[model samples]
Target: MAKGQTIKVEIKRQATPDAPSYTEKFEMPYRPGLNITSVLVEIAANPVNTEGKETSAITYDSNCLEEICGSCAMLINGKARMACSALVDRLLDETKSDTITLAPLSKFPVVRDLAVDRSVLFENLKKVQAWVPIDGTYDLGPGPKQAPQIQEERYPLSNCISCTICMEVCPQFNTQTNFVGAATIAQAKLFNMDPSGSVLKEERLRALSGDGGIQECGFAQNCVQACPKQLPLTEAISDMGRDVFIQKVKDFVSR
Candidate 1:
């Protein structure tokens, strides 16, 4: 991890969603305070491969490069993580290698090079009704008061940036099943905890009770470790799992 050394980078690329995929080699001068995004930006500005041949600019999604938007999520050295937070120096130290590897999430459909379709998460959240219900956009007076303790509990869940690293590392979130993954479940728990949002609690719980539901979770707990936000994902999943079970039992008994 010395300064001004050349860091070799390998990027997985695809011209289009249906196009054949390829890998490109790049060389970036190791610099102080260099992040993965910086490496990508440099390649984008230069668009030259290791062979000194001109190449297309790398395609990827990014916004609020501070890890808030979660758009810079990618497989760094074969691990799901945020590229914006992945510093080249620290990465080299962690891996004991001068070469860095970048690839799109394996489970997702690659839109281009490092970009993938993550709208599935939105659809999952939609199924769980992961938002507070409101009648109109009209001025709704100050809503229900939340205890400091409750607020504290909810804060961590609220920090989830939808990076999908949890899903990427999840075994259940594969082609074999339609498991909604940890982000969706955590959001369901977050909204269900809200005073106003609790109105749809029963519906939300029911949504997760059937196929591709909470029962599908393998409880590997990878979500807890991979989440960039460090969300209480395991706790949320556990609480929601209990609630979903009780909800299903209630539905059965009432029938």
Candidate 2:
């Protein structure tokens, strides 16, 4: 890309959560290494539509230009992705079009233009008790050590930034089923495997046993594909599913 060349961007905007949505087009000078977030910055610098009409600066959420923050997740080119890492050149090359499309994640409630409510994922995490149960803040010296093999398995699961892309791409993640989605399942597996977090393993397994639980997964595997961190989502879900089944059996026998 060179100076004087420009990229056309189409953004889906809504003035408020209850307001109607409209599309706004803008042209920004093309620059090398420009990601979707950078394009938004340029638009903020000059909030003019394609018709040359002055407009409100595009409202979007972003922080940590790097992909680590996970707050910049949105639909880029009709797919769930992180705006901070969606490179303009690669996007244009992929579509072979001068124009790129941006929108809020489809499944989430629109908090504002390009920003959606992803609290559902956090709420799901709470449902599964996706955390190690620490009894006290008091310095209890030397916790039980984990084996190196266990550490290797837990590391990738810990990389989940709760971006909710996995949920966004899932077909089962809708109001009808109220499915907890794969992120919650993956996190359940993560904490359940922990040397200390395993204290809540039975509770986590029980939590996943009923409606909106692991059984809701269609196994489309979209979650694994859409995950920015390349987590073993399917593997975690499978393991959790097996564990949940075993937990049910154990409960039945104990009765």
My TM-score estimates for the predictions, one after another, are 0.98, 0.97
Q: What is the C-alpha lDDT profile of model 1 across 88-186, one tens digit per residue?
A: 888898899999999999989999999999998989999999999888899999999999999999999999898889999998999999899999999
Model 2 segments more than 4 A misplaced: none
Candidate 1 regions with alpha-carbon error over 4 angstroms: none
**Among these predicted structures, which one has the highest TM-score?**
1
Write model 2 residue lDDT over 100-137, tens digit each, in one string. 99999988889889988888888999998888777789
What does the lDDT read for residue 215 in candidate 2? 89
What would the TM-score be for candidate 1 when compared with the true structure? Answer: 0.98
